[model samples]
Target: MSFFSIFISTANAAGSPLKQFEIYSIAPMHFGNVNVSFTNSSFWMLLVVLVSTLVLSLGVRRSSLVPNRLQSISELLYEFIANMVRDNASQDGKPYFPFIFTLFIFILFSNVLGLIPYSFTVTSHIIVTFALAMVVFIGVTIIGLVKHRIKFFTLFVPKGIPLALAPLLIIIELISYLVRPITLSVRLFANMMAGHTLLKVFGGFVVALGFLGIGPLVVTVALYGLELIVACLQAYVFAVLTCLYLNDALHLHH
Candidate 1:
């Protein structure tokens, strides 16, 4: 193919909303019966991890008596998650503070990373989000089981309820409990995927319509601002929900 043809093909492929989500192997490999090949998704995840670690460490490396910009941000995020835990999950949730804080930072970084041009959004994939949610779900379940033993089952049964309606409520509660991962995963994945897709669509219009695309380009710029907010908000929402779930398992309020 000619150079111009190649460039056109590349540009068109890059503009597709779904194209950004594609998982292509970077260094294809196999582990016996499993395909554990490194992929764009995997690469992005590693990048996120590295960046998170670097920022947190370097941010406070100086440990100044008076905080720098980096130190201030690190402390702000730390206190934010700590206060959130205190308010939502109470002192009982203190032991799990590190887990919750790390969870928030990871998702928050993943969302922000996806905003980079041509970067993959790991949370946009159901499997990634589902895996994270499962950790929270299973962790809480184990905590409940270990703490309350068989009595944890009583969480599904409310006090002073009519015997006739007990079975119905139990079934409803059981299903809801089991479906936490699904809802949690879908909420993050759907929002990130949909918002990114909309941005991609507008971007394509800008390239295709040229001068006539000025309006769409402006909307796309506005969307970038909104998506940045959403990226942070979704991370906060997921973290808060996890706290609520943790509280439920720990205290059985609902």
Candidate 2:
């Protein structure tokens, strides 16, 4: 079965860990071989995009020498992402700031939005996260090949390696490089899925345990707080890693 379709069975069919990632056709449509239907996942994705755009647009509508609260928040995010790219990818990375910034914000917003009662988290799906990772992976690979040509191969062969060990190290490096998308996608998906599953399970306890559930409720509150922090952190880590990959591509550094 297809990776995206794997979530189909469990997502909408039942109330299980996988149910949160389910995508169903809101208005099912078919164009020959392709199914172009608007599903809940699509709804959430559009909502994420809309909300992100609105916040960013309104946040800096009135740019000023002395920033107000919204403008300050906007500037903070701008500078924060700028510094991340600068630190990891340097001046050359400045050109891709918008892409990186959009990605960071989108994921951050999605994660935070998911914490809302009865809301869906887009990043919890492997297909979604994998697509995002693949974009970065492919983009970096293209940049490296375009900039360095065949020399991009050197990325797999570190300097000062003994001649005999070069083959082994090169193989290891190649495998690691190729697995980036798998690891990146799985990390975000697993984290969101695990966090939400815990919340769901504990929520059931709260409803079932009644007054005694106060302790679990308190823990739930703390978990929510931690999840918020994690939402922001995972976004930062994803963007930072993107910059790092871009740095590798641009400079061909080992």
Best by TM-score: 1
Can you tell me which runs of candidate 1 are displaced by over 4 Å? 1-14
lDDT of 2 by residue, 47-164 (tens): 9999988887788887789988887887899999999999999999999999999989989988989989789999988899999999999999998999999999999999999999
> What's the count of clashing pairs in each model shown?
0, 0
**Shift in Å, residue 238, candidate 2:** 0.6
Q: What is the TM-score of each candidate against the true structure?
A: 0.93, 0.92
- Clashing pairs in model 1, backbone N/Cα/C closer than 3 A: none
Local distance difference test scores for all models: 0.91, 0.86
**Lowest lDDT block of 10, candidate 1:** 6-15
| Collision count of model 2 | 0
